[model samples]
Target: MTWHGRPSRGPSASVRLDLREPARRARPAVPHLPHLTASAIATWRARMLNEHGSARVFEGLARQFEGAGFEAHLVEEVRGFADEERRHGVLCGAVVEALGGEALTEAPVGEAYPEHADDATPLESALRNMLSICCLSETVAVALIGAERIEMPAGELRDLLTQIYADEVGHSRFGWRMLDALSQRLDDEIKERLGDYLEVAFAHLEEHELAHLPEGSLPPPEGVVYGLCSGPDARGLFFDTVEQVIVPGLERHGIPARRAWMRRHGGAGLS
Candidate 1:
């Protein structure tokens, strides 16, 4: 469901997929079939596509940061993040293949919101992109991945997920660092603008994670076994991450956490 709010300015430019093929290095063969059902395989492939798609978003952010004359160090950090995301896509593809799915080739198409808005200033766009992708999405991903890793039996899947989790922690930290640096420049107008965008970003993230399911439906059992949370668990984690981690962090950096927006959106609703 969509949040009730003013329409965000649509993406000014489309994201270009990074069509570079993953390295052709041989992967270790799985000794036995994974306990995944057809639906589980499909979920894994979808996640693979999502990971692959993220490379494009990160690349776009890197380009935007450079074009906006952000600091050289931060620009380089973003570029490195792009490379890391591409690697994550490749790793995820390997997991899919191990689980009897076809290799991922095409990156998914989507905009990183803040960078997509034509009306926003470069810094505003950058801040929005950072908040949506890094602060919210990647941060939640780290928690999800860690939970999955904990539940997964010792196997190739768990190992690969662990690697991704490590990288995600760094990526989330990068978002925070950028936000902290950028916060120094945020006047009241920018801060208010951030508050307005926070609800939109939160809704966007919720859609990304749960849009395929019918309203009030839970994730399948295979999904839980394969490291995905049930609908209730996912919803709980999202809100908890916002309230306990993201919101507090933002407030510490002098940005409003927009608690009213969360309340308005039924952020407290059970899945």
Candidate 2:
């Protein structure tokens, strides 16, 4: 799937997918529906605008990663992520604008860490920092795209969302592998820090955040793959990664993920 470079200004660009059944078998992260309406749609759109920043965010992260001593390979990986993130900004911005609204171009919904910043950053490199970015971030994105099946208006918008979703899986897998490789050599202190970082990241994801995100179905015109327009359990699906996936993986490494890290300098470091 590819971004058609079209503005998602209507029902056409907004699509949702129902990957709950498949997700349950895979990780048990499913969206439970109640009801949906235009208000719900606006709520989700506003949430995205409030939570996520403009395309500048992706560009910012890319520059920061490159400035850091990250491997060329890792930097390249961030490029891919940046591409997707930039496109998401465009698609989301278009959706909100088309709906006769404005997107937040100044402050972002979530706070961003600077490139040269210390452990005060969410992108702290120690431990599972990369994993949180890749595995956890991408995993939730994939599930979110799936949950869209119920909420998406069913058309071109659905296609764009899915395209973004599919790409996230690979990104998540790559981050997972990177962490897995580092896991063997990492110490218990680093693992503890990773756990703490992941916990913090999870706090940023609330159900209401992505609840109204649109979804779509393929080979449409016949019928939608999921519900016409239903609401999913945004809260449950959002944090599935840390609770169900990443946390367990950390535990297997004997890492204490739930507890807060006591030290200020403990995390992926620059030195």
TM-score of each: 0.78, 0.58
Runs in model 1 lying further than 4 Å from the true structure: 1-35, 105-117, 212-225, 263-271
Best by TM-score: 1
Candidate 2 residue 94 Cα shift, in angstroms, is: 4.5
Q: In candidate 2, which residue ranges exceed 4 Å CA deviation?
A: 1-68, 94-128, 150-154, 206-232, 239-241, 258-271
Where is model 2 poorest over a 10-residue stretch in terms of lDDT? Answer: 1-10
**Each candidate structure's count of clashing pairs:** 0, 25
Please write out the lDDT profile of model 1 over residues 1-271, one tens digit for every residue: 1111011224454444332244224232443435544545565555655665566777778878877789888888887877777676666556556656565444324644346556788878878888887888888877767666776677666777777788889889889987877787789788877866777777777665555332454555555455544555655666777778887888777667655236436565342
lDDT of 2 by residue, 94-187 (tens): 4444344444333323345434356633334522345545555556656656665546565554665565566667666766676676677766
lDDT of each: 0.64, 0.46
Q: How far out, in Å, is residue 12 in model 2? A: 33
Among these predictions, the greatest lDDT belongs to: 1
Q: Candidate 2 at residue 159, lDDT?
A: 63
Q: How many clashes would you count in candidate 1?
A: 0
